[model samples]
Target: MQLVVARIGRAHGIKGEVTVEVRTDEPELRLAPGAVLATDPAAAGPLTVASGRVHSGRLLLRFDGVQDRTAAEALRNILLIADVDPDELPEGEDEYYDHQLVDLDVVTVDGVEVGRITEISHLPYQDLFVVERPDGTEVLVPFVERIVTEIDLDEQRAVIDPPPGLIDDRAEIASSRASREEA
Candidate 1:
């Protein structure tokens, strides 16, 4: 499996050090020094990681042979992909690879069909599962233990216990309010 580990950002200094927007959970293993990564454009890499450092809370990397700011800047926005084993799993029981969750059916605790997992949005604080409903609408479900009650990989589904307005239309609230006013 080819997993995207990071996206190259701007050149940090006059050297060939570029900041990266890390995408994977295992950056230390995937983006470490001496690691070789493939690029999205297919021509920008196979780049080897010459060195890496943390600068102002961000990760900066110096790729072998990329010796200048212009060279590093040129690699900006390029995605770094690493070849991973299909059977390889993350080291945590509750953790999962993005690929494992994508395409899984989403359902309510009562077995109401909601949608299918379409994408995983990795935010700084939390992750979200982008689900595509049968009607073509999309919902963003926070990947939290409280909301996502269960992930049954064997059943290929995710069971959620969404708050009242989280899944249902908010217009239901408005309708009830209007009815009470009429009464």
Candidate 2:
């Protein structure tokens, strides 16, 4: 599978260089001279990395054939993706990629299947798992260690307590807040 590693922001200087917002933690490991990277799915050819270096907390990349400000401006908002195997990812125990957790089945401690995870939102304090139920209701579960007991990526399942009425209470609170803001 192809994973997004960075996004081309804008032309940094007049030296045919563009600033890249690095998404991967191991930017040095991923960026290299002559490395192949894809921008979009329909992108004709992989962009060859002529050179790359970190400057001002952002990755500065110079692509082959892209010279001058006009050429670099054309690459703005292009996402850089690399072919990566999911199994090759390094994850510690109880850690998983946000993409992997999405679409996984969720169950309770008693083995009762609740719903399927549709999305994962990484908040400042904790991660939130958005589970979609068969009845079309979405339950936003907090990824707290106390609430979420276990996560089995291999089995594509997660065991969570979620607290009684926690989902409904949060939904009501959100609705009320929205109404107040609209007033």
Candidate 3:
């Protein structure tokens, strides 16, 4: 299987180096030197990593045969893909691959069927799971330990404990909370 590992950003310097927005958690291993990655456009690569370095909290990489700023700029916004084995898992116990989470059934702690995970969105601070409800509507569920309690791969489901108004409409949640408080 092929997984998107990074996206080529603007050229960093005049030495063929380009900044990359890393998608994979294991950048040191996946984006290492001599690693050959396929490009999204299907014509920009397969670009081999000639060298890589962390500069001012950003990852910069230079590809083989891509020298100078002009050459690096030409590859801007291109996505880098890596060939991965389907059975390969992440090193960390709690870490999960985006492919593994996608398509899993989403349910509340009370066993209420909510939706199915359609996609995983990785942000700088947190990750979110895009869930498609049975009614065909979509909801963004924050992939946090507090909200998402468990991921049962064997059962093909994700158990979530969402806060009031998280899954339901805010007005409904507000009225329900008020009624409970009154009682």
Local lDDT at 153 for model 3: 96
Q: TM-score for each prediction?
A: 0.85, 0.61, 0.82
RMSD of each: 2.5, 5.5, 3.6
- lDDT by residue (tens digit), candidate 2, 14-70: 877999876554556666888888876446347989999878666799999988888
Top TM-score prediction, candidate number = 1
Best by lDDT: 3
lDDT of 3: 0.92
For all candidates in order, the CA lDDT equals: 0.92, 0.79, 0.92
Relative to the true structure, candidate 1 reaches a TM of 0.85
lDDT by residue (141-177, candidate 1, tens digit) is: 9999999999999999999999877777446678988
Candidate 3 Cα outliers beyond 4 Å, as residue runs: 134-137, 170-183
The order of the candidates by lDDT, greatest first, is 3, 1, 2
